[model samples]
Target: MSQTINYQAQSPTHEIESKPFDEKNQVEHVNDVSAAKELSNFKMDAMEAEKAEHNMTVLEAVKAYPWACFWAFVMSFTIIMESYDVFLIGNFLALDEFKRQFGILDHNTGKLVIAAKWQSALQMAGQLGALIGVFLAGPLTSKIGYRWATIVALIAMNATIFVMYFADSLPIFFVAQLLEGLPWGIFIANAPAYCSEIVPIKLRAPATQVLQMFWAIGSIIVGAVTYHYNPMSGKKAYRIPIALQWMFPTPLLVLMFLAPESPWWLVRKGRLEEAAKSVNRLGRKSRLNANEIVAMMRRVVENEKEGSISYLELFKMPDLRRTLIVSGVYAAQNLTGNLIANQAVYFFQQAGMSDQTAFALGLITSALQMIFVMLSWILTSYYGRRPIYIWGTAFNTVMLFALGIAASVGKSNAASQAQASFGLIVSVMFTFAAAPVGYAIIGETGSIRLRPLTTGFGRAVYYIVEIPCIFLASYMLNPTGANLGGKCGYVWGGTATVCLILAYFFLPEMKGRSYRELDILFHRRVPARQFSKTVIGPEEDE
Candidate 1:
């Protein structure tokens, strides 16, 4: 059985005059104290109401929000398109046919080899365009809404894929890669923000985790396709994978028209009625009170207006701390040696493995990553965010350092090969748990009005870090360059250790908080450790 209490009617702001504890009134006084305590508990319940129904379990929340889950799953395909190209380009770099078309002859080894500069350029071009797109996401999403922004991005992305498919020279390929990155940046910036806005607090982590899971799924598809097409010569082998990019965005574009606009975005734009309707659509069968949810959203929007929505505000007082934490978390993701996983096919090939063996290992890594991402969704829901993040960071640091040492010992040695392979697999598995959670955290940390801008800014910082990291990774791994191979892990490992310490001290637990409650907590300057236990009442001053 369930009961509903009207805590809103018993406003905590009402005052009770202090009276002397008299023997005649002692029983009444005791009753008064008990009632006050119960009221306090009720106030806490009201604050958490936005997070979930008064007493609903996570399973119940899922059963209630099937449409929300479906929407999240559909939006996640954008990540698949992004992930496909990430693995596709790396695998192509190691392909015999791709090498024959693009590589210069290395007389010493009597084999065609792509130069380190070209390889680095290929990866960095996308990052450069992604940086630009991230900066543009704020205005794009703000103007047209996430749905239309994504649709426009998809249209542009498909156009670029055609260019990439027909590209013959390195310069043309670079241009195509840069062009492809524009939409990817927009999708990455907006998709998780959309997921955060539409789903219940309990489901946010899982929904965003699904976004990352698709990334691994894309990698798996590319790995398998590239391996199967290994025997083909010239453009045919690489063209097939390049053409596959068209599959994701075309259907996603049409689906966006059917999707509802983000309720938060509507509220920010002063479309209150539309926002309420969006909320009802998203929370159709849920226990959530749509009117109450809209009211909460309105309160946050009104509060946000007190502080203007400017980029400079992101660095001002209360928002500054959040901006730093979110940006740093995104940067920390890159420092986990994920680039090595991104370039796994090439890394294995450079270490003297056959093309088939290298692609097979890449496929295995992606499969393991997909499995771990699903596991992370469950773990994130049960264990909360900070502990899992800390644990994953610690594990990544140790594995990277170990792999670096193994690579430094001797690349061709059987012992080194086994150690490096083991290190790559284990490090990636650990990384899946923490790395993707950063997106959910970034989405949750911002004020409702600034959500898109905050995520876009965070992603811009992400690409700023990624651009140099990708270039450095290509330099160290490309056979024509420094060829550090597994030793590159040592670089990222040292940085991951620093990120681990920062996360422990700064990343607040935001597992079950609504966007409105998060604004209050951040405004109040609550300590990270106390976020989960601290009870906030409506009348409490910010």
Candidate 2:
């Protein structure tokens, strides 16, 4: 625990001259009184809370102070990297010669190959590593705190990236992947929750979207790099890009230590004075009061007492259980064909395009994905979650269905070429609609008490499902198979379309509400999705 020093406001040292008794001095005194009132208002928590109650705009708060923009920018480095990691594999795999050289060749014909089962086994191993790391997030945040937890995850992830460059065989490569996955998971789940807690409530949703925007930008940049460089061309092959991934986490490790622990987390741990000091530093205003600090502390403490702290207890309550289940269902977003479309650049090659050409196409598709993600960020607060969730999923499903139909009917050399181009466009549409909003929906589905647990569970489930889905797509699209690429695209598109339709009816709209309000939602007697439109009594609303 940080030691807290008592704060005392400093006064001017010089004594006033006798001439201060004049009318000029009287005017100065009135001005001083007005300044004090303004400072007092700035320190008042109730006034800020009231502003939120009236639905105070995020733009108004950010405009009132520009430094919030700096923090948003700094935070973007971590999230953009998260976005990059999510999609980097897509372009890298698209390199045709790269896959051939790596020994992932025609069925039973490769020299340096790990069996498909082993490749997928490696994927599962990586997912398991992530699950274990995610399980530690809350307690680690509680112990050394959020900033340090971020630093630890950063260091571990970057180190794993460096080690990855040395791997020559499947086992060594798989181990590196497993190690890398551990901390990337930590960065993904904790970074948003950390950013959300530190900023003003009004800026919370936008800040989350800002993080998402960085993610989109990062993905686009990586896609562009791999596309243009054609990472598989020379002797360097995939090694150069694989080594470059480490660069994302290296600088962030140093920056994490410079940042402060979350004030909300500190306050919940009975370190109110330290929380106040941290909050004051974050706001860059030295005059924040102890009373205002105490109010925020009290709110977190009340939540800590009432909510589940253990992983088991998180699943015990009916409402919390439903919330977890609802959140987990969106795990399908990660599992359903989106990732296969996003990550299967190599498989697309079997469909017909050359590796370099496939990556060039991927570069265009990723740009579209980024643009739509930016649009989702802007509309999330204004249009609300339910409509976006419904439409985004619905539209993505339609695109997937089209891709499936196009692939199913196409067969010869010319027809296969046409279907490949058509499938690529439809896949881009799927990513634009589904890939960006997946995190937003997860971010909104639960209260702080159950938030980390639910996120961890959902992420674990996503990866678990992803391991099989990825390899299955790879297997079906193996270069030796007849109508290779067409078959995999058809299967993935059809399955994902079904999962998305189910989600439209089940996912709740979490737009424009406080974290505290989410508890009331899960605790309600009605079904989880209905909570979006149902009005509660005044006492229940409280």
Candidate 3:
């Protein structure tokens, strides 16, 4: 990527203009060494740099850009706390002290518990807040840049933690969660895009997948922490875990200040000098040619410079398809039944397991999810996203169906065990394929011009989908409600089946392709299945 060359296609007389040039000539010189005279006389210096980066082996790219990889991982740490907070509230409902503080007496179950309506309300409160946060993240990060935007969010998240820690009632806790969602939204939506930008093309998927790993890691910690505190009888039980959440942002905050800024974001703003410096910091070891790489980024920025920069643009032409694809990718995870698996502690408790077993199973399930997410790094590399995502959805369909069958076998211990086992299996399949892949795709799918904003719109779709699912789960799991237990599997199973069909028709393979290649393919409106075989350039390099 460091090498520079002269473009014989002499267009020195052509005035500099910011418009989407002919896509046909975009890659003409990139991989061609023949006498195919380049088009328009415009030098392919930028395309050449990008081609070099794209042609790199995974190992070559990693060794060359170690600091970029390091910062990507570090920036993703914010997700750990975000995940922790998400699970903490659901599990807390099962704690003795939490029940006393927030639960209403349930005559049917003859026990104290948070009402189903309240449970769904609490979950939605956070989702509503996150939706608002996602809306802000795109513009906020765009204007201020990732580093400062993150600093602002971390500080805001810490401030919200105080409210969660001191809350003595359900209403107060609800407000706290709702408020906390603002920053959590910022972190979740922006983290993947930031990570995607810092790493080289070969490492992009793996880097974005790290966000899911951190999410599983966060869930595991919350499970262990919540399980250990399950024996407590007072407010300390819940407060201690909430207090630990405050610690996540501090270390992440420090790392944010210390990490290199995203070179892509810098280039988008026409700040080449800053972008070059950022690139040098990220890949100094490999001797990255900042001038060439910056030009490469500039071309990408130039091509996407069409349309006024606004959310409305996201719904227009090429970007609309990009928007729908990303939105579908995000929504697919929820359809696969993450809401239940994510809160296995609460899901298990309602399914007839004792509190201790419920917590233990939740921990084990979370640990398994983490392990599978680790496995995803390998699967994604070999199988690419299209197959893994489709296969995972198919597997989800079967496992959720089996879970429903087990639940319908009646309330026997064996039936309960069968339901629990299937839930774990479903979670395993999800993390290995559906769950992790969504994070990666969100990073890769959108146009660079409006990535964060598009991601926000996509996440908004997720919360919109989840809102109905939350209400459904509340009705199904609530003792005062249907108390369907594992029978709820039928609902998610149906959703997974729908998602599978949709993915088959819509999802495309983007395994080793660069953004420029992808841009050409999408512009031509190629078939989704033809993505891998339909070559863009005449002699596109491997």
Clashing pairs in 3: 9-41
Best by TM-score: 3
Candidate 1's residue-wise lDDT over 38-146, tens digit each?
7665455445555454245678777777777888888888988878887888887888898888999877678888887888888888878888888788788988999
* Tens-digit lDDT track of model 3 for 329-370: 888878897877776888788777899999999899888888
On lDDT, the leading prediction is: 3
lDDT for model 1: 0.80
Stretches off by above 4 angstroms in model 3 are 1-42, 285-287, 538-542
What tens digits encode model 2's per-residue C-alpha lDDT throughout 38-63?
A: 65554355334433433547676565
Residue 6 of model 1 has an lDDT of: 46
Shift of residue 398 alpha carbon in model 3, Å: 0.5
Whole-model alpha-carbon lDDT for candidate 3: 0.83
lDDT of 2: 0.60
Q: What's the TM-score of every candidate structure?
A: 0.89, 0.80, 0.91
Show pairs that collide, candidate 1. Answer: none
| Candidate numbers sorted by lDDT from highest down | 3, 1, 2
